[model samples]
Structures are given as C-alpha cells and as structure tokens.
Target: MIRTFAFDVGETLVRDDRYWASWADWLHVPRHTVSALVGAVVARGQDNAEALRLIQPGIDPSAAYQAREEAGRGEHLDETDVYEDVRPALSALREAGARVIIAGNQTVKAGALLRALDLPADLIATSGEWGVAKPSPAFFERLVAQADVPADEILYVGDHPQNDILPAQAAGLRTAHVRRGPWGCLWADDPTVIEAADHRIDSLTDLIPLAGQ
Candidate 1:
C-alpha cells in the first residue's frame, strides 16, 4: 500500500501557460519577452541567470533575484489560480492514510504558489525550503529519507518523463504520469512511456482510484 505521495511542483501543480503570462505582465514586457528569455536560455545555451541578464539588463544577477522575479510573476498570473480539483484529490489520499508531499525544482518559498492555491501547509514536505533540484540522486535520497517511507511505499506523480518519472522510478517509487498539462505533447509523442508508468491519469481526480487509498 502507498503510504506517502510526492508531486513535482512546476507544470504538475503549477500551471505553465499561466506562468508565462505572469512573467510577461510583471516585467512590463511583451508575452514573447518571456518566450525570448526561454529561447535565449535554450538557444544561446545559458542557464536562466545568464538569459535574464542579457534580456532584462537592469536586474541584479543573483540566482534568487532572477528566480523570484520569474516565480513571483508566474504565481500572480491568472491571479494565481489554484488547481481546484487537486485539493480534494489530496484530501482524499490523506484521509485514506497517505502523507502527501511535493518535490520539485524551484526556488525557496516554492510553496507560495501552493499556499496561494490554499493547499494545506503540511503537505509540502521538506522540498521547497530546502532548495533541492530534481534528477539529482542526492535530492531524491534526501526526500525519500525525510518522508521515512520506503521507496516502494511512495508514489510520485508528475508530468515530465525525465524530471519526474525516470528518477522517481529509479529510486524505487511507483510512478504516475499526470498525462497532460504543460507536457501533453511530449506524452503524445512518447506513448511507449506508458510502459514505465504504473498508472496514468488525465487529472488529479483520477489519482483517487490509482493510489488505491
């Protein structure tokens, strides 16, 4: 039986389209400004900091400064809409004897979006404040150890193949693909991943049955 549930933050619970809109609004720039920043990072091949310094120029170049500006804006986009259904899914799981936590690549205070969405405090676990990035074995080790649930007893639900499914499965956690959101097209392209997934859901609501309480 699954005793603990962990989730990825960005594009899993946090909506990515809305995240882009907020980034555009905050810097008093066009929507493509956000796109350009991403393109600059991917195309010019620099991390987020170097991209921001090139695109924005005036802002301080610290990691925190760059991340907060982006994260803060994303949270404010669409007035920070919560995943309304996600809450009930989590509540049901918790009621069914699972401890829910989120592990994602994000800045400190990463739970602010979840908090704005009104998720319960304890559900966030040790991730956000601790500043762990994904695909790192050490990050996964620390989170699993903190939850105190054997890897087999935890299910990590996320949307990405690389950042979410592969690493978690390698760590011995059961995996669920959220199946569509930011990563929808990638999922469509690679249906073979279904082979790796223990279960699949279109939305958080479907998780109720999959986790088997």
Candidate 2:
C-alpha cells in the first residue's frame, strides 16, 4: 500500500504560468515567446532553462533570478497559482490517513511561497533547500531518506518524465506520471514514460484511489 504521497511542485500541484510570466517580464520579452521557447526546449528533451538562455544567450538564470528579486519581481505563489484539484486531492488523502508531501525542483524563494499558501500537506520541500535537484540519484536518495519509509511504499508523483518518473522508479519508488504540464502532456504516451510510471493520472484526484484509503 502507498503510505506516503510525494509530489512535484511545478505543473503537478502548481501551474507555472506565473513563473514563466515573471521571467518574460524580467527579460522584457513577450510572454508568449518565453512560453513557446519553454515548450520548444522541453520538446527537444533539453532543460527548460535552455529557453531563457535562448532568449538571452550567455544569460545566468540564477543571477537573473536574484536581479528579479532585487527589482521586486520574483517568484510568487498563491491559491490562484495552484491547480484546482490540488487542495481537494491532498486534503482527501491526508484525511484518509495518508501522508502528503510536496517536494520539487523549485528554488528557496519558491519554497517559501509554497509554504505560505498553507496547502494540506504534511511537508513541503524544495531542491534549493536540499542542495540537490531531480534527475540526480542523490536527490531521490534525499527524498527516500526524508520519507522514512520503504521506497516501495512511497509514491513520487510529477509531471516530468525524465526528472520524476524514471529517476524515482530507478530509486525503487512507485512513480505516477501526471499528464497536465507541457512535459507531462507531450511525453504522457512515450514508451519510456509508459514503462516507468506505475500509474498515469489525468488529475490529482486520480491519486486518491491509489492511496488505498
């Protein structure tokens, strides 16, 4: 039985529209342009940050992120930024005596923002706080340690196939591929994703039944 449900932040629990919009504004580029670039890079199986680099060659995303904060325009998250199904599904799972955790490859600031929303999760963690990012075995190692349970009993859910499904599966955890974000939608039916994911879900609510409550 799945005792713990750990989720990816971007496009899994939270929509990334605001994030991309902030970047577009920071770089003074059209919002659609940045969005398009992100899709383009993801389609090519490249890092999404490649879109930013494509917009402004040689740009340092971290440095640019700090500059955006200094200028009072940085990562922001609120109830509106969350997907409609997030609260209901997470809350339901928790109510059903399942542990719900939010862990993703987000920055420290984004982590803080996520906490401020007060979602019904037992824990909220970010890659920035952990000093490790996904697609790395070390990151999943941290997740397994934090979960404090047999890896097989934990379910790692995310919208990214490469970062979430494959790595988590390789780490011995059951994986759920959520088909919501660009990456999720585009690779939802890919053979690797289909093979790696133990479950394929259309929405967060789909996880409720899998929680075995």
lDDT of each: 0.68, 0.92
Residues 88-183 of candidate 2: C-alpha lDDT, one tens digit per residue:
999999988889889999999888999999999999999999999998999989988888988999999998988999999999999999999788
lDDT of 2 at 20: 98
Which residue ranges in model 1 land beyond 4 Å of their true spot? 26-29, 32-80, 125-128, 188-192
Give the TM-score comparing model 2 with the true structure, all chains together: 0.97
Top candidate (TM-score): 2
Query: What lDDT, from 0 to 1, does candidate 2 have?
Result: 0.92
- Best-fitting candidate, measured by lDDT? 2
On the 0 to 100 scale, the lDDT of residue 30 in model 2 is: 97
TM-score of each: 0.76, 0.97
Clash pairs detected, candidate 1: none
Q: By TM-score, how accurate is candidate 1?
A: 0.76
**Candidate 2 local Cα displacement, residue 43, angstroms:** 1.7
